[model samples]
Target: MSARAALATALDRIERYDEDIGALLEVDAAGAAARAAELDRSESHGALHGMPFVVKANMCIEGRIASCGSRMLEGYRAPYTASAVQRLIDEGAVPIGIANMDEFAFGSSGENSSFGSTRNPWDLSRAPGGSSSGSAAAVAARMVPFALGSDTGGSVRQPAALCGVTGYKPTYGVVSRHGLIAFGSSLDAVGVLATSAADVERVLAVISGADERDATSALRAPFEPAPARTDLRGLRVGLPREYFPADLDGRVRQPLEQALDDLRRLGAELVELDLPTTRHAIAAYYVVATAEASSNLARYDGVRYGARIAGDGSLQGMFAATRGAAFGAEALRRILLGTYVLSSGYYDAWYLRALKVRRAILRDFQAAFERVDVLAAPTSPTPAFRLGEKLSDPLAMYLCDVLTVPTSLAGLPAISVPCGCAAEDGVELPVGLQLIGPAFEDARVLSVARCYQAATEHHRRLPPLVAGGVA
Candidate 1:
C-alpha cells in the first residue's frame, strides 16, 4: 500500500477510536498527509518507504510538539529531531504525531501524564503500562505500524506487554539519545513498539548505528538484520527463579507456562538460573535513574525554555513557582527524591551505594549469560491493572517493573513478546514473555522472539478496540 493509503487508515482510526483510548497527545494528520503525498510522488526514497508511525512525546521531531507528557514544555517545538527518529524519517517512515507518556517518563502507570492517562486498548478501564503507554496502545489499536518510545526502566516493554505488542529496548547506546528529552540519562534508551518482533527488527536496523551528535552513541557498525529462525535449536533459555513469585496471579502464570512450553517445543533448553542481585535491581535502578533525571531536568528553569512563573520579582522565587506550577505531583516527587539521594551528605550513602548495586546487577547478568543465551521472565508483575488501581500507592506502582528493571540496570537488550491472554471478567488481558540478551546482542533477542512468534498466534491477536479483533 502507498504511504498515503496507510496514513489515511491511521488517521481514520485516530478519529474513530482515540476518544476512548487517549493514546495520542497530539495528532499531526496534516503534516503526515503532506509527507505521505511527497513520498508517493518520489521515484526513490528509502527502506520503510511510506510507513506511518508515532513517536512518544519525549522524542523530538523537528517542529513537532514534544511535551514529554509534562506541562512544563506544554507547547515546546523541538529545533532538531532526535537522532533515532530522524533516521526513521530518513528511511521513509512518516511520523503521525506524539504519543502520550507518563509525565517526564516518571511513572509506571500511564495515569501520571499531565495530559491524562492512556488507556489500554484491550480494556479501557485498565492502565496501559507506561511511560510508553501511548506507543504500545497505538500499535495495538493498529493506528500505526510502529511507535518510537524511550525506555528508562521497562517503559516500552511493560506497556507492550499490557497492550499485547512487541516492544524492544536495544543495548545501551545502540541508538543515539541526541534529541530524546532527558529522563534517567544512563538507563534511558530509545526503543521500538510494533506488532511483532520482525517488525521491530526492521525498524531497529534502520535506526541503530553510531551518531556523531551523541557522545554516548556506540561506535559500532550499522545493525544488520538477522535471518529468521524457525526453531531455537541449541538455544539456551534461562528462567530466573525471581521472575515467578509465589503470589503471581494464576491467570498470568498459566499463559507464561504455556509460552515456556512453546519455547521448549521449539528445541530451546530452558535452564533454571539464579541472579541474587535481582532483589536490589529496583532499589538501584530508582536511585540511579532519579539522580540522573534531577541533573538532566535542572536545565528547565524559567530563564530558558518551557513554562515560567514570574514570582515576587526574584530569581529563586520565580524558579520555585515555575517548577511548582509546571511539574506534576509525580515529577516533583521524583525530583525531590533524586535531589535527596544526590545531596552532599547522603550522596555516598544513597547514590554511591546505588551505583555499587548497579554494578552488582550488571555482574549478575554477566554470570547468567555464561550459562544461557537469553533470559525469560514476565515483563510486568501483573497484567494491566485498573487505571486508578495503584496511582495512590507509589510502591505498588514501582513493583510493577520488578521483572524488568534488572535488565535495564545491566544495560542489556530486551524485548517483550505477547505470550497469551489472562481471561478476566468479560475482558481478555494480554501477558508478555520477556526475552533478555547480553549487551549488544540485540539481533539474538529479536531472533528468539521471532522464532517464538512464528510458532504462536499471540502476536497476531489484536485488541478488542481494533476493528474485527476478538480481543
Candidate 2:
C-alpha cells in the first residue's frame, strides 16, 4: 500500500477504536498526510520509506505538542525534534503523532497519565501497562505499525507484555537520549514497540548510535544486522530463580514455562542461575530513580517550563503554588520521596546505599552472563489488571517492575515477546516472555526473540478490536 493509503487506514482505525482505548493524546493527520504525499511524489527515499509511526509524547518533535501525559507541560511545543526521532524521519518514516505515557514517565501502569489512562486493547477495562502505555496500545490496536517509547524501569517492556506486542529496550547509551523528557535519567533509555521483534530491529538499525547532543550516548559501532535465520542452535539461555517468586500467578507462570520449552525445542540450552541482588532491585531502583528525578525535575519550576500559577504570594510561595497546581499527585509523591532520600542526613544512608545496591545488581548480571548468552523470565507477575485494580495500592504497582527492572538497572539489553495468553474473565489476556542479554548485545536479544516468535505465532495474534474491524 502507498504511504497515503496506509496513513488513511491508520487514521480510520484510530477514529473507529480510540474512543474506548484512549491510546493517543494527539493525532497529526494533516502532517502525516502531507509527508506521505511528498514521499509519494519522490522517486526514492530511505529504508522506512513512507512508513507511519507514533512517538511517545515525551519525545520532542519541533513545533508539536509533547505533553508527556501531564499538565506541567500541557501546551509545551518542542523547539527541535529529538535526535533519534530525527534520524527516523530522515529515513522516510513519518511521525503520525504522540502516544500517551505515565505523567513524566513515572508510573508503572498507564493509569498515571494526567489526561486519562490508556486502556488495554485486549480488554478495555484493563490498563495497557506503562509508562509507555499509549505506545503499546497504539501498536496493539493496529492504529500504527510501530511507535517509539522510553523505558525507565519497565515502561516499554511491561506495557508491551500486557498489550501483547513486541517491545525492546536497547543497552543504555545504545540510543541517544537527546530529547527524551527526563525521568530517572540514569535508567532512562529510548525503546521501540511493534508487532514483531523484526520490526523493532529495523527501527533500531536506523536510530541506534551515539550523538554529541547526549553526553551519555556511547561511541560504538552500529548494531550488527539481525541474523537471517531464527535458529538458536548452541545458544545458552538462563532462567533467574529470583524472577519466579513462589507467589507468582500460575496463569503467568504456565505460559512462561511453555515459552521456555519452545526455546529448548528451538535448540537452545536452558541454565538455572541466580541474580542474588534481584530482591533488592526494586528498593534500590526507587531511591536512585526518584532522587535523580527530583534533581532533573527541578528545572520545571513555574518560572520556566511548566505552567505558571498567578497566586498572590512571595516568590517562594509562587513556586510552591505553581508546582502544586501543575504537577499531579503521583508526580508530587515522587518528588517528595526523592527529596527525602536526598536530604542531608538521609543522603548517605538511603541514596548512597541505593547506588551500592545498583552496582551489586549490575555485578550480578555480569556474573550470570559468564554462564549464559541470554536470560529468560516472565515480563510481569500477572496479565493486565482492571483499570482501578492497583492504582490505589502504590506498593503493588511498584512491584510490577520486579521482573523487568533488574536488567534496566544493569544497563543490559532486553526484549518482551508475547509468549501466550492466560484466560481471564472469559477472555485470553496475553503474557510476555522477557529475554535479557549483556550490554551492547542487542542483536542477540532480537535474534532470540525472533526465533521464539517464529516457532510460535503469538506475536501475530491481534486483539479483537483490530481483528474484527479489518475489512
Candidate 3:
C-alpha cells in the first residue's frame, strides 16, 4: 500500500475504535491527509516518507493543542511545532494526532490523565502503564504505526511493555527536547514507540542529531550501522538482584524466567549484578522529577500561554484564579509537593538529598556497566492492572515504576520488547523484557531487543481491539 493508503486506513481505525480505547485525545484527519497527499506527489522523500505517527500531547505540534493531558491547558494550541515533530515531518512522516498522557506526565497508571484513561488494548479494564499511555496504546491498536513520547521516569518503557509494543527512551541529550513541554527538564527525553525495533530505529535516525535550539541535544556523529549480530555469544547480560522484589507476582515471574532461559539458549552470558541503589530509584525519581517540574511549570501562570481565569481586580487574584481553575487535582498536587520541597528551609532536606541519592544511583549503574554489556529485567513486576486500580494511593502508583525508573534516572538507554504473555483470570496479559544499556549505546540496546524480537513473535501480536473485537 502507498503511504497515503496506509494512513487513511489508520485514520479509519482511529475514528472507528478510539472512542472505546480512549487512546487519542485528538485526531487531525484533514491535516494528515493533506500531508499524505504532499508526500505522494513528492518524488524525493526521506526514510519516514508517508509514514503515520502520533505525538504525545505534551510535545508542541504547531496548530495542535498541546494540553499535556491537563485541564489547565485544555483549549491551548501550540504557537510552533516541537523540533522533534518538525524534524519527523521534514522526513515525510504525517502526525495523525496527539496521544493521551498522565496530566503533566506525573502518574504511572495513566489513570491520571485529565482527558480520561487510555486502556491497555490487551485488556480493556487494565491500565496501560504510563505517563506515555496513549502513545503505546495507539501503536498497539495500529491507529498509527509509530508515535512520539516523553519519558522522565519510565513513562515510555512501562506503557510500551503493558501494551506489547516496542518503546525506546534514548540516552539523555541524544534527541532534542526543544518542543517537548517540560516535566522534569533534566530527566525528560523524547522517545519513540512502535511495533518493531526497525520502526523505532527509522524514526530515531531522523531525529537523533543535535539542534541549535536545544543546547542539550547530542552533536551529530558519523553514521555507523549497528552491528548485525543475532547471536549473543559474548554479550554480558546482567540480572540485577534488586529488581526482583519479594512480592513479585508469580504469573509474571514464570514468563520472565522463561525469557531468561530463551536468552541463555541464544548464547548470552547471564551474570548476577548488584545495583544496590536500585531500591532508592523510585524515591529519588519522584523527588527530582517533581522538583524540576515545580520550576518548569511556573511558566504556565496564565500570563503566558495556557488557559486564564478571570480575576476580580488584582494581579494576585488573576494568578490564583487562573491556576485554581486551570489545573486538575493531580497537577495541583504535584506542583504543591514540588514547590514545598524546593522552598527555603526544605530544599536541603528534600531536593538536595534526592540529588545526592540520584548521583549514587548513577555511579552504581556506571560501575555495573563496566562488568556487563546490558542489564535485563521484567519491565514491570506485574502485567496491566484493572482500571482505577491504584489511583487512590499515590505511593502505589509510584511503585509501578520499580523496574523501569532506575535506568531512566541514570540517563541510560533502554528498550521494552514483549517477551511473552501471562495468563490472568483466564485472560492473557503481555509481559515485557527490558534491556538497559550505557549512555549513548541506544543502538546496542536496540540490537539486543531486535535479537530477542527475532527469536520470539511476542511483539508481532496485536490487540484484538483494532478490528473492533473484544480485548
lDDT accuracy of residue 117 in candidate 1: 92
* lDDT by residue (tens digit), candidate 1, 228-330: 8889989999999988878887878999999999999999999999999898989998888889988888988888789999987799999989988899988
Report lDDT (Cα) of residue 216, candidate 3.
83
Instruction: Please list the C-alpha lDDT of all candidates, in the order they appear.
Output: 0.91, 0.91, 0.87
Prediction 3 global C-alpha lDDT: 0.87
Give the per-residue lDDT digits (tens) of candidate 2, residues 1-471.
688888888899899989989988889999899999998888887889877899999999998888889899998989899999999999989999889889999887889898999999999999999999999999999888899999989999999999999999999999999999888889999999999988999899999988999999989866666666667889999999998878889999999999998999999999999999999999999898899999988887788676888676778777778888888888898899999999999999999999999999999999999999999999998899999999988889999999888888888999999999999889889999999999998998998888788889999988987788864
Off by over 4 Å in 2: none
Cα displacement (Å) at residue 19, model 3: 1.6
- Model 3 Cα lDDT, one tens digit per residue, 216-329: 887976224387777788999999988776767886788888889888998999999899998889888888888888888888777877778778758888888898888877
Which TM-score value belongs to model 2? 0.98
Higher lDDT: candidate 1 or 3? 1
The TM-score values for the models, in the order shown, are 0.98, 0.98, 0.97
